[model samples]
Target: MMSDQPNLVTTCTFKGKEYLVKMNIISGNSLEMSVTDKYTTEEWQCCYDANYIENITHKTGNFKQFDIFTTMLKSGLLKTSECVSLDLLTYDDLEMLRNRRMNGRNLCPSHSVHTNNVNSTSNRRYLILTYSVEFDRIHYPLPMEYCGPPDPQVLQGIIHRLEGEVERLQEQLKKQAEQYPTNNTSHISKLQKRIEDLSAENKTLSEDVRYLNKALSKHSNSMRHIGMMKGIVNSLQEQVIRDRMTSHRQIKRLQEEKAVLKQQHTSSETSCSKCSKDCFSISDSKCLLFTTKFSSLL
Candidate 1:
């Protein structure tokens, strides 16, 4: 539900123009605010949720339209004005207006509808029909002060002050122009000297960088050569290991063959000695037989 009466009514200056601001509390504790220009009668309205207002108050939200309002509210620039509340009579009139239609499109007049018959001198007014973006129709009375144009005297005074400010700025500029040449010459010289020094330093740094790059290249080549040498050394070490293993196996086989040859030679010598002894005994037996036969024949 929304309230018929405005919660707050205040006068504030927005964008250098005086405006009448009205705030109403709507459903879910949201705020519906309307701002009407005092001179132009132009109106702008916006609805802010409770969380949105909280964020704006906490400086976390950045709504350009309402940021100035929040600032003015905090700075006491929004002067609170008395709001004419809706009475029973005014409520009945609003109900009737809601039903009544001027055309087929349900258009309402901008003027207020008063039910009471009061004296002509009584300047008290009631609801004025207005339109808002959030609501189709809003009943709020415009303040009397906001209905007319701005004071000419105030505008003239502002113009006069601005003219004086312009003259003062022009004088300041003229004085600066008079003094600029000497200051600029010295500043330019100093800048040129600084630039020359920087250039020299940059040149030195460039040379140093080039030297470091060349040294790095040489070191890289040396590292690659060292890696190649390491690979060659590893290959030679492996070949030496294989040669030593082969030589050890060959030595073991030769030793085994020599031992077998020595055993065979010892057996052959023993057999030869036994055969010679047998030959000598046979020859002696044959000679004795021959001598016995000759003696018998004689």
Candidate 2:
């Protein structure tokens, strides 16, 4: 029932991208607002495990678990606040909350709820609870105290196993040393040969690795060159299309001009024929004599 406010802020730099986070205050613990791209909320009651709570507390020095739990108890904000107020609440609440819902989830003591889509006005979904430290001190159990070292029986068993392994290794070594003593020149020669073989194998491995790396680099460069070539080809294709369009327009204009010249030539021929006919009617014999003379000259 506490007044809603932004409680915590978190920031992280991931792969050169900067992200900011804001926390919300609600019943007793902070809950992440899922509507934001920056921050994800987790229930405080869910992070009661030793490691989960510690990690968040170490990272965020605000709002400890003890503080939140106590606040929740005093304000009757816990799910079992009525039982808690009467001292009737036992460790079952912790067991149930841990085993049931909040087992693996981590809680941030200084997380924010001020992300977009939180719907702070009508939905009331962005609010989170911040518990009191006193309540946590009283309710949250401490880690199991270690009494001393392991039992003597376990220590004896471990030692026995180790001794057995050592004995077996010693026996094997003795047999090997006896079979190929330092005095045996042939054994030394074989050892040297084995060392040389191993060295050759190592060299081969190194060469393979170097060759693979070179091949990968070459392939990467080839891909880059191919991409560049594709871009150039696309640009050339566009230029070709533009040139074709211009040529098409020129061809159309030339065709129109050719049609106009053909029409003019046909009209001139028709006019000449009419004039010749009109002159022929004035004197058929003269026209006939003129045609004969013209034909003879042709």
> Candidate 2: deviation at residue 40, Å?
43
Task: Please state the error at residue 132 of candidate 2 in Å.
Answer: 91
**TM-score of predicted model 2?**
0.22
**lDDT over C-alpha atoms for residue 14 of model 1:** 40
Global lDDT of model 2? 0.38
- Where in model 2 is the C-alpha error above 4 Å? 1-220, 284-298
Per-residue lDDT tens digits for candidate 1, residues 217-273, read: 446764454344334334433433443343344445446666787888888888888
**Local accuracy by lDDT, each model:** 0.43, 0.38
User: What CA RMSD would candidate 2 show?
Assistant: 32.6
Q: For each candidate, how many residue pairs have backbone atoms clashing (under 3 Å)?
A: 0, 26
TM-score quality measure for candidate 1: 0.24
